[model samples]
Target: ALAYAAQAFQIPCVVVIREDAQLTKLQAIRRYGAEIVLVPLAEWQQRLELEQQRRNLHLVHPFDDPAVAAGQGTVGLEILDAIPDLRTLIVPVGGGGLIAGIAVAIKAQRPNLRIIGVEPEGAPVVSESLAAGHPVAPSRLDSIADGLGAPYTRAFNLSLIERFVDQMRTVSDDAIIEALKAVAQQAKLVVEPAGAAAVAALLADAEIERPVAAVLSGGNVDMDRLGSWLTR
Candidate 1:
């Protein structure tokens, strides 16, 4: 949706997907007439910079882009508006864009509201960064949640997370899968693995407070993988 929206608005956009991303995303981008860039895990950062410079791309940092952040902030605003008494918000952290934006908006309006970030255990950049007291790249990137599999944390995202997020948790792939199934059966929502990380954290961690709302970030899942997962 973000890519479509950007394209619709005449923004020359190119999607950067992991090298191993399923064919579904590729097909969708092709169908939508958008450019797709596949970056190998080893060369992502360098290639990204080179590509941006080569194309003179108007780079929009997923986490640091003010416009994108503001757009994500609207989610926090809507949550507060709908649940006036809401005291906490749980957000899944991939590159930290969504949580950073939500934290900023929620804290600005309700300073006391706690904002938590959830990450996949296999790719816990945010959690590991917090532990190391600085942004640290993961030695190995391995996660079923492709969206959340950022090898390195951006400085801008790290700053926002350090300042705004109250807590962070990491959950395993099995836990994430259970959360996905639960949401499918109960909420009737199809969520990607990264999108369900927050729910997985909530289910795995018993200490979380009630009245907590989690962001189900995206619903783009490969049909073949979804069927395989369901059968498993």
Candidate 2:
């Protein structure tokens, strides 16, 4: 998305991606003419900051900046516009920006509505942070959902999530794959694992109330991966 925006304005954009980031996502960024810097998964956050400082780049942080969160809030507004009577919102969380932004927007207009966040079990940083009542960093991030493998949530994002979100749940890779298959077969949506996290939670739990909506956030999986998972 940032790459596309930069392309629109004809600005040079550099994306610092984890070494293990999805090949499809890397290809997409390159297609938008963005320069890519691959950093080790453990050092990505530090390298991103250093790169910004060294280049004097105008950093559009993935989840930390208020401006980015505000932009993501538009998704919430659109959701309400489409479903005014929505009782529950299920959002997939990585660094918590998207869910934070959505929660703020939805809670402002509909405080009574429930907002739930879903995270990959392998990298449930948001879930752990919320449980600890503070920001918590995961020791390691190991998930098929590369987009949902954030190592930690920043304080600002965590605060917003704590304030507005009602619950946080996690789904295993198996559950996520199952949900991805279901979405493809039933909903005819070819979604990536991160995109299916919310659906995974919804399918795993039967107690969630009616009028629920799950955000499908991406569809940039490698074809080989999709084929392998589908055949499995």
Candidate 3:
């Protein structure tokens, strides 16, 4: 959606994804007119090539860019506009961009509103980072929530979470799968695992306050695997 927003202004963009990334997400990025590159792993070499070419290009880090974070905060603004009396927000954390920005925006307006974050148990980047008082990367991450598979969080994003967020939680892949089904059956939302992370927390034996808004972040499930996964 962020890339789509950029393309609306005719801003040429190039997106890099893992070779195994969801086909639905890749196709959507291409549909927005952005160039796509599928890499095997961290392709810093290709990034260096872009720097050499320069072309006045600013490499947009997906979640660490200040502009990107601010842009994401608009979701919080929209939610407040629609539900002024909302008391809590549950957002999925990958690299902490979405929740950090939302916390900043909502807390500025309603300081008392609780802001909670959830991530797949396999990749507890934010929670682990907070615990160590610094960013920490996991050696091996395994989860069905591919969208929440960021290896680590940046220091700036970590600081923002430390300042603004109220709680950080982790849920298992099984929990995410259950939440995905619940959203599909109960809410008619076909969300990816990462998108269902917050809902997963909600579905657990959690002590949550009412008037809560849980952000369903994405729906780009790989159609090829969607049916089998949904059935199981």
Candidate 4:
């Protein structure tokens, strides 16, 4: 989305992506005319910092920027507009921005509504941070849902999540894949693994409140791996 926006405004966009990122996502970014730099996992941060400094590019923190979060808040507003009687909202958490934004917007109007965040058990940044009562980064990320594999959390978004979000849940890779398949087969939505995290949580736990709405976050799945994921 950011890359597409930059393309529209004729802004030069340089995206520093992990070397292991899904090929389809990379292709999509390139289609928007952004320069792509694939960096190794261990050197991504350093490479990103150097690139920003060299090009004088304004770093758009994926999930930490207030403006970004505010923009995401529109999703919450739309949900409220669509489902006025919504009792529960389940959001997939990557760096907590989407859920933080949605929670603030939803809670402002519906204080009684329950908001839950689900992430991969392999990359449990939000769950761990909530447990420790502060922002925390996992030592390593090991999840199929790379979109939800944010390595760390910052205080800015963490504070909002801690304040507005009701609970954090972790779902296994298997559960996420199953949810992805179910969504494709039943809901007719070809959602990515990260997008299905919320549904995985819903399917895993039967005690969640009724009239619940789960936000499917993304749909850029790697086609090369889709067959194995579904058949396995």
Candidate 5:
């Protein structure tokens, strides 16, 4: 979708993906003539800053970008339109982008709605930041949810979440795997571990009530890992 959108707008876009991303993604990028930059885990932040500085890359905050946030907020809009009595929303947190965006959108429309964030137990930047009342980087991050493995939470996302999010929680890698399997087997959807965290929380007696909506963020996962997780 991003590639197509960029092509439609005649934007020269490069996709910076993790080193271990699927080969299909690489093939697709090459097929579309989009530059693909592979980033190693240790050098991700440095390379991101370097790319931003060198390329004058327009950094789109997943949650803080108004347009992106507005689009995410539309999820809240649809949810409310479908179920107006929604009291709470639980979203997975990476750099705090999606939740931050959703927080703003939901709060703007329904000031009293409860919004919560879920993070990997190994990479609990948001939870730690919220505890300290400031954004903080985790010493180390280890999670199967590649999308939610951000070592640090962004300032904008942290500020918004601190202000608008009602609570934050962390889930174990084992729990995330369980959630992924459940989503695949029961829900019949191929959701990545990060995307399935909300369902994991729901299954773990996390205190969320019925009639709540969990954002299944993304479906990108390695096939090998997916098979291993399913067997386990």
Candidate 6:
């Protein structure tokens, strides 16, 4: 989305993505006309530094950057503006960036409103960190939601979550798949597993406060996997 935003103003955009990431995400990035660099999973971090240094470009952290958080917070503002009576805000948690941003925005204005975060059961990084009172990297992350496959949560987003988020919940892959189908069937939104995560929480649990707003964050689903995903 940022890449597309940059493209509108003809800003030079370079995206460094893990080589093992899903092709659909890469396609979306490419669609925005960003120079896409495929970096090895282990070497991407170091490569990003070098790439930035080589071009004197300001590196943008996906979910850990302050600007990114501020931008994401607009989603919360929009939701609040559209639904003045919104009581619960359910957002999907990966590195906790989106939820962190929204929590800050909503909690600042509506302190009593609930801020719930949902994560994949296989990669419950933020929830675990909130439980431990600090960030901790899991040894493994195995989830169909590649977008939420961050092995750990960083300080920036974690601090905001620990401060403003009301609760963190996790949903199973099966539940996520169901949520994806439900979104397509009911909401008419074809969302990816990560995008379906918050909806999954609402579907799996009946305790969510009504007048809820769930942010369907991304829609970059692999067309090739559409068959298996819809069927499974």
Q: How does candidate 3 fare on TM-score?
A: 0.92
Residue range 94-126, candidate 4, lDDT tens digits: 989999999998899899999999989899988
RMSD of each: 1.7, 0.9, 2.0, 1.1, 2.3, 1.4
Cα error of candidate 4 at position 127, Å: 1.2
| Candidate 4 vs. true structure, TM-score | 0.97
Looking at model 5, the pairs that clash are none
- lDDT for 1 in candidate 6 is 78
Worst 10 residues of 6 by lDDT: 131-140
lDDT of each: 0.82, 0.92, 0.85, 0.90, 0.79, 0.87
Best by lDDT: 2
Worst 10 residues of 1 by lDDT: 58-67
- Deviation from native of the Cα of residue 195 in model 3, angstroms: 0.8
Candidate 3 clashes: the total is 0
Put down candidate 3 lDDT per residue, 14-85, tens digits, no spaces. Answer: 776767788899989999887876775466346635643676666677688788788899999999999999
**Regions of model 4 farther than 4 Å from truth:** none
Candidate 2 per-residue lDDT over residues 187-207, each given as its tens digit: 999999999999999998888
Please list all clashing residue pairs in model 4, or write none if there are none: none
- For residue 92, give model 5's deviation from the true position in Å: 0.5
RMSD of 3: 2.0
Per-prediction TM-score: 0.93, 0.97, 0.92, 0.97, 0.89, 0.94
- Candidate 3: which stretches are off by over 4 Å? 44-56
Model 6 steric clash pairs = none
For model 5, residues 1-232, the per-residue Cα lDDT tens digits are: 4566677788877776678655645776676666777998668667766877799877644344667766676777787898888887888988887787778888988998888789988888888888888888875587877778886776777888888898898889999999999999998999878899987877787567667888898786778878999999
Candidate 4 all-Cα RMSD: 1.1
